[model samples]
Target: MVLKNLIRIRRSAARAEAEHPALAAAGLLPGLEALPNAILVLARERLAIAFANPAAEAMLGMSLRQLCQLGWTDLFPNADAPAGAIAALREEASGTTQLDAVLELPQREPLRVHAIIGSLDAAPGYVLLELVENEQKLRTDREERILDLSAVNKQLIRNLAHEIKNPLGGIRGAAQLLELELGANGGLREYTQVIIKESDRLQTLVDRLLEPHRHPHIARDLNIHEVCERVRAVMLAEFPRGLTIHRDFDVSVPDLRGDMEQLIQAVLNIARNAAQALRQPIAEGTACIEFRTRVARRVTIAKRPCKLALDLRIIDNGPGIPEEIRDRIFFPLVSGREDGSGLGLTLAQNFVQQHEGMIECESRPGHTEFRILLPLQC
Candidate 1:
């Protein structure tokens, strides 16, 4: 709809040009500056940029000043001849002429975009460039896959918990009997103690695994900041010395109906996971975590679209998530850490799902961000 309206505006500007030619030269498409899709108007004669839209600045991951300093070759230095791509763009002006290449950055990931160069109908030596990130579509598809796998994981976790529960009691009882029979024999009783201790630990883990299924959700009206504060206070208490939990919140956000405890657990689990990763850095006095919130509009979660939703981001600066297990991090038994049970994120995912929300993680060296989307009212 935005794209269509922008196109209509451009046509109107063109038609009004005969009466007001100055408007056509100076303000052909002033509104494109706010467009979501990245757009750049390049002066074909000088091979320099005339304008970079706000979306273009973000999509390119550079400031407007930085982008204006770059030419077609400077942006795509490795490409075979982006100039030819631009030359062909004007000839085949029916639609966007798609270019089959990626925009490489200095050290970051190569941004994938469908590049199309269009020519200005009124001007001969000016071309328009459009770039749309492919990651957005991939994310939408990933959400569906996550929901399907989450359903399967939920049943599997329940069945595994029940299976583990029965034998766990028998093992603990047998170990206790063995320990009692071994009475004063210190060496042998210690071994039995180990067995009993391990059994008890497993039992505790099994109980935790069944926790979400065991409790009935207690829903209530609450501000999300309350939840953030609750989590922030706990994190500060645990790692008070060097860790900083910054709050960047939208105070105008309205309260959403949710299970306060569940939401708190959900946020806590994610925040705690980040804290654990930041442990080494915290000791060196450089660890930081951000709890940022914003109002997300026209959002979709769990295959349901909400007019309003909360976009909560937990950003941390630490050695990024291990790439090997990143894709399956939310699975019940998957863990990036060797000693981790890997159920924190799984349970967090479950709690958010209970509120008809979704969580996604993006990680790279030195930067990791977890975005949670919960409906304002579901």
Candidate 2:
């Protein structure tokens, strides 16, 4: 009976550390100093609260003194063989590590988190464990909703464009015929000419709307860096003086299969927008644009993981996106600049969606990052 009791005590201590590793590490159990968040640190040997964030107090429902007074065994009554788990984790070499587990709080339900464990260089004989809630499930749900809406939006745009095309041609033809009937200098003929011009303009818009669908998929193995380089050259030539363009790429990333021309256009559209945004900075000769790429794994695009994804970030150092129009920046016909057509991003998004990808934007004063997430296949 005594052996069983000792075993239970050890198990309880282990459970305590697992629940509040931060407190155990900081040794905050004895004096509950108010901290910002509910974070607890645990030490390797004793499994006692070393430090606790204010958030931890709310989460555990215990005062610092109360926590310090209780032994690990007293806190966790039903923990089984907890000491063994700690021993196993400690045996591994010191480095950043992660584990997914359930943590029970006082009078509260068990919560799940991906616990990150690593040795702290600043503190000797101690480890740091940070809890990050597993948000993959929620991300998956959001991706699904966005993708479903994008697919539906694409189909509607395509159908609408097709329906408008035939009528548009007829209208242009009728106007042309009317113009020919009232040869030169006829006031009424000018109206027909105007009709033809407006029809042509609408036709251009419709063509752009249908372009992504009409273009045949031309997937070929190509280097993304090459694409970015080509875009950089073109933009530099177009905007020659006063703007500095920087390239930051992950050279290790292998070639991906995609339409080279479409990718170029998509990138160009974004780059052009950045260049335009830098008008003020360019005048002062301090405007800059950066093209950066990295590898992202298990990224969900359109509700499914393509397994591997490329993170292409277009950064600009200029006045950030205006707060009034930031949220609607991706919507069609929304433009922050007075002279902007607002169709650039719309077209870019359409092209990217065709390539089975997604785009996200983040902006703050003097900084903006547009991230394009594209899938790569082996």
Best by TM-score: 1
Query: For residues 193-287, what per-residue lDDT tens digits would candidate 1 score against the true structure?
Result: 88888988888888878878999988899999999999999999999798988999999888998999999999999999999998899999999
Compared with the true structure, what per-residue lDDT tens digits does model 2 show for residues 221-306? 99989999999999999989899999999998878889999999989999999999999899899999999999888777776667
Local distance difference test values of all predictions, in order: 0.82, 0.73
On lDDT, the leading prediction is: 1
TM-score of each: 0.74, 0.65
> Given candidate 1, what's the lDDT at residue 339?
84
What is the clash count of model 1? Answer: 0
* RMSD of every prediction: 6.7, 13.3
- The runs of at least 3 residues in candidate 1 whose Cα sits more than 4 Å from the true structure, single-residue gaps closed, are 1-70, 76-112, 115-131
**Candidate 2 residue-wise lDDT at 167:** 94
